[model samples]
Target: MNKFTLLNGLVVPLDRANVDTDAIIPKQFLKSIKRSGFGPNAFDEWRYLDHGEPGMDNSKRPLNPDFVLNQPRYQGAQILLARENFGCGSSREHAPWALEDYGFRVIIAPSFADIFFNNCFKNGLLPIRLAAEQVDALFKAVEAMPGYRLKVDLERQTITAPDGTVYPFEVEAFRKHCLLNGLDDIGLTLQHVGEIAAYEAKHRAAQPWLFA
Candidate 1:
């Protein structure tokens, strides 16, 4: 996982609520757990006009002109501005994988599903919850200006708008620490490698026959 410290990047609004995990990355493409290559297939159903499948040539597929992501101005956006209940439905971890793979480091929404919210932190994606009115303001700003961007300071736990307006958000202390250090569950465990090795060595010596 990548450490998230600060980000100043373009913001694109998805303007939709109740966006389920399936829509974020369609089920057909969930065959791999590589946590990559899903960027091309993010929002597959709405991004393309035709049905998508794994191993399909997405480059050749028809793109939906009406889709927000397909618009030229929103290209290379790293911050996603969304409405309430942004991520809902089945708790597939793939959803955050696809979002992170798609270059979105931070997702700002009024609310998010419990599981999806937790998944985002594990995948190094910052899912920020703000007041509905604040999200509305962000969505409006993003659409009103091309190349709209914001500054997200995780350490400060605040989002700075283009006009210098600041919004303070809250995150669990443990989750904040993990993201700041880029430590996932596996990484957290590995931090105590010496202790783990010591315990194993002692166990083997105490019961040598068990190992045999």
Candidate 2:
């Protein structure tokens, strides 16, 4: 996981609502436990036609032009502007893995699925919840200008528009701290290493018989 103190990137407008985890990353690609190598297949069905393993045959995998991600203008986009209930359905961590692999660092939506939202932090992605009206404004800007970019400052919790307008967003204190320090669940637990070691040493001395 990487620290997410701040992020500024081109916004890819995905106006659809209720985007489920399966659509983000199809189940067939879930075989790999590692987080890498899923970006190319991020939106498998939508990103490529012939609807099968992308690596199996290059000729079989044809990029879908209609898909928002397939659009050349949206290439290298690191921020996603989407509608309500984004990342809904299933608790698969692969959703965030695909998004992060696809170079999306922050996703701005009116709402998100509870599980997917929680998983974003562990994989170094920021799922920002904002008012529906604010999200619409961002969508409009990106729609009007294909490569529209937004500047996000996590420390100030503000998003600066291209024209210099700034909007504030809310994030929990603990989540903010973890992202700032690049602390995933394992990283978070390791924070108490000294205390844990001290407790183990005392316990071992008190229960030598148990150790034996």
Instruction: Give the clash total for candidate 1.
Output: 0
Candidate 2 Cα misplacement greater than 4 A, ranges: 54-60, 190-212
What lDDT tens digits, residue by residue, belong to model 1 across residues 10-55? 9989988898888998898878857678899999999999999998
Name the best candidate (by TM-score): 1
**In model 1, what lDDT does residue 93 have?**
85
Clashes found in each candidate (C-alpha, N, C closer than 3 A)? 0, 0
Residue-level lDDT of model 2, residues 7-96, one tens digit each, is: 779889888999999999999888886778788778788878777663565345788899998789998999988889999998989999
TM-score of every candidate relative to the true structure: 0.88, 0.86
Error of 1 at 13 (Å): 0.4
The runs of at least 3 residues in candidate 1 whose Cα sits more than 4 Å from the true structure, single-residue gaps closed, are: 189-212
